[model samples]
Target: MKLSKGLLADLRLQPELQVPDAALLALPEKVLQFGTGVLLRGLPDFFIDKANKQGLFNGRVVVIKSTSKGDTGGFEKQDNLYTQCIRGIDGGRKVSEDIINASISRVLTATTQWEEVLSCATSKDMQLVISNTTEVGIAYVEESIHNNPPASYPGKLLAFLYRRYQHFNGSEESGMVIVPAELIVDNGTLLKATILQLAAYNQLPTDFITWLEQHNYFCNSLVDSIIPGAANIDTGYEDELLIMTEVYRLWAIETDSPRVKEVLSFAGADAGVVLAPDINVFRELKLRLLNGAHTLSCGLAHLAGIDTVKAAMANDSMAAYIEGVMLHEIVTAITDKHIRHDAAVRFAVAVLDRFRNPYIEHKWVSICANYTSKLKARVVPALLQYQQHTDHVPALMALGFAAHLLFMKSPAADDPFAAYYADLWTQHPAETVAEKSLSDSNVWGTNLNTAVPGLTKTVTNMLLALQREGVNAYLERVAAEIIIS
Candidate 1:
C-alpha cells in the first residue's frame, strides 16, 4: 500500500505506525515554510506535526518550493503525507518510531504559484514563517520585490511581507514570527537585515519599515538532526516523501519576545523545542564537539580506508583517537568560563555515541567536503585555545592536522585550497610543507607556528610518520604515547 491520506484509515489499524488524527486535516494553515528539503520536513515539520496531533498547535504548513527543480506531484499524490522513520540511540537506549507526518497542508512552487503564495500573506492564521534554504540561501542580494517571484530568498520574503503589510495596513497585531533554520550564525538577524535592505532597495514606504521593525519578531534558531532522506530504507509501503532521522532532535530558538513564545506554543508539547534568550552554548557544543570532531577525524578516517563514521568507530584505535580528540582536546578548549566543563564532557560523550550510531551511514568523504575551511573554522580555534591553556601541543590535533595535509596532497581540481596546497607541496619539499602551511596567515587567519610553539615540528613529524607507518600504525603509536603520558 502507498502512503497517502486516503490510506490513513487503514494505516491507523497498524500497530507499528502512529497515524495523525483525522481532525488535524482541517487545521488552519499557520506556518509559511520556504523549503521542501528533508531536514525541514524531518525536524521543524516533525515537531509541528507532533504538536498538532496533541491538539496543542493546530496549524498546518504551506510550503513554498523556492527552487524550480522538482515538481509537487509527490506532495499532491500523497496529500502532503509523508512517513518519518526515527531510528537512533537516545540516552544510551535504542529508539524507533514510525510517524506519518501531516504537517504540510500544501506545496506550491514559488515560480509558478507566486500569487497563491502571496495570498498566504493576508491570512490571519499565518503567524509564523520558517525557512531552511541552505547556508547560501540566506545571503544578501540587491533585488527588487516587484518581480513575479523575486530573485532571492530575502527578496521573495520581502515581497511576501510587503503584501502582508499592505493587507493589514501595518497593524502590529498582524505581525508574524520569522525563524530561519539555516546552519549559519545569526541566521534570523542576517535574514531580517537582508529583508530590510531589500525593502530599501525596492523603495518601500517608511511606515512599512517601521511596522517590520517594531511588529515582527525574527528568532535565530539552531536545528540538529540527521535526516538522510528515505531512499535507503524500506517502511513496508512506498512513500515519495519518506524521511529517516535520528531520534535525537533539537530546535534551539533564540528569542525573548512574549508574543514569539506565545505563538510558538508547540514548545510546551516537546522537549526538543527549546526557547532561550541565548543558544550560544548549544551552538558552541554542536559546532565544536559534533561538527568539529567530524572535521578533525574525517581525513584520518578516510585515509585509513574507513568508509563510514560507524565503520571508523568500530575500529578500536580510530574510535579512541576520536574520543581523545574531542574529550581531551576539543572539549577542554571549549569548556571555558562561559561553558560548564561537565556539560561539555557529557555533550562530547553523546557526540561519540551519535558517531557510533549503526543505522547512520555518514561517509568520511562527505565530511571532508571543503576540508580546509572546516579545519580553519572548526578545528584550528580549539588547537590554538588548547595550546594557550596548557602551554603544550595537542598531539591528537596535530595528528589530525597532518592527516588533513596528507589527504589534501592530491585533492580534486575544483577544491582551491587543496589545489593551492598541491602546488605548495610541488614547489616546497615535504619537510618544509608543514612550516609553509602553518605560517600561511591567509589560511589560518594567523601564523599557526607562531601561535602554537612546536606545532610546525609536531605536524611535520606526524606527517612523515603517517606517510611511512600508515594511519592505523600511527594512531596506535599516538594512543600508546597518550597512555604513557
Candidate 2:
C-alpha cells in the first residue's frame, strides 16, 4: 500500500516503525521551510516529526519549492507523507528503522504561488523559518523585494518579512525564528546581514527595519547528518519521498533569547536538538576530525583503488593509516587551550567508528571534489600546527600529500589546481615538482618549503617512493615508519 495519512491506521507495520498520531495530522502549519531537499527533510523535518509524534510540538511544515527545476508532483501524490530509512552505526551499535514522516503539510511553488507563500507572513502560528539552500544561496544580489518572486534567496526572504511587517504593523510578537542550515561558518550572521542589505537596497521603511532588527531571532545552527536521498531500496510500499540517513543526528542551535527557547520547546523531547549560547565546539569537532580526516585520506584511499570509505576501512593498512592520522596527528594538533584533549580524543574515536559504518557508501572521489580548497582549509592547518607542537614531521600526512600530488597528475578540465599541477608536471622535471608545489604561495598561502623546515624534502622523497613502489607497498612503508618513530 502507498503511504499516506489515510493508510496510517489500516497498515499493519512492524513494532519498530513509528506511525504519526491521527490527531497530530490536524496540527497547524507553523514552520515556513525554504527548500525541498533531502538534507532538510531528513534532519530538521525528521526532528519535527519526532516531536509531533510525542505530542510535544503540535506543528506541521509549509515547504516552499524555491527552484523551478522539479515540480511538486511527488509531494502532492503522497499527501506530503514520506518514509525515512535510518541505517547506520551509532554508539558502536547497528541501527535500522523506518519512520513514516508526516511533518510537511503542503508544498507550494515560490514562483507561481508567491502570494500563498507570503500569506504565511500574517499567520500567527508560523513561528519559525528554516532554509537549506546550499552554500552559495546566501549571497547578496541587487534584487528588488517588490518583484513577485525575488531572484535570490535573501531577496525572497526580505519580501516575505516585509509582508509580515506590513501585516502586523511591526509588532514584536509576530517575529519568527530564522535558522539557516547552510554549511558556511556564521551562516545566521551572514544571512541576517544580507537581508538587511537587501532591505536597504529596496529603500524599506526605517520602522520596519527597526522591527526586523529588534524583534526577530536569527539563530546560528550547525546540522550533522548523512542524508544520501532515496535510492533503489524496497520499503514494501510506494514512497516517492523516501530519504535515507544515518541514525546519528545533531542540530546545534545558538540562541539565548527566552522567547526563542520557549518557541523551540521541541528541544526538550529529543537529545539531538541542542540549544546553546555557542556551537563552536560542535563546528570545530566536525571540521577538524570528520571533514579534516576525509580531506587528508581521500586521495590516498582513492589511489589505493578503494572506492568507498567502508572499503578503505576494511583494509587493515588503510584503516590503520586513517586512525593514526586522526588520533595521533589531527586530534593532537586541533586540541589547544579552547578544546580539551579528552574531548578531541573521544570525537576522533567516534569519527573512526562512523567511517567504518557499513551502510554509508561515502565515495572517495566525492570527497576529492574541490580538492585544492579542501587541502588548504582542512588539512594544511593541521599539518602546520602539528609541526609547531611536536617539531617532528607527520609521516602519515606526508604520505597523504604524496598521494594527492599523484592523484592530481591527471587533471580535470574545471579544476584549476589540478590543471596547474598537471602543466607543471609536464613542464618541470620529476624531482622539482615538490619544491615548486611547496613554494607556490598562491596555492598554500605560504611557502610551505620554508614554513615547515623539511616538508619539501619529505614530500619529494615520498612522491618518488610512491611512484617507484606503488600505493599499497608505499602505505606499508609509511605504517612501518610510524611504528618505528
**Candidate 1: Cα lDDT at 271:** 92
- Tens digits of per-residue lDDT for model 2, 309-409: 99998988888899889888988788898789899998888788788888888999999988778888888888899899899887778777887888888
lDDT of each: 0.90, 0.87
Worst 10 residues of 1 by lDDT: 410-419
Q: Residue by residue across 1-485, what tens digits does model 1's lDDT show?
A: 78887899988888999998888989999999999999999999999999998888999999999988869999999999999988887777888889999999999999999999999999999999999986339877887798988878998898999999999999999999999999889999999998888889889899999999999999999999888887567777789888889877899999988999999988877898999999999999998899889998999999899999999989877888898889889988888988999999988887877887788999999899998899898888888889988999998999889998898898572345977898988998879899999999999899998999999999999999999998889888887766665
State every prediction's TM-score relative to the real structure: 0.95, 0.95
The model with the greatest lDDT is 1
Candidate 2 worst ten-residue window by lDDT: 10-19
* Model 1 RMSD in angstroms: 1.9
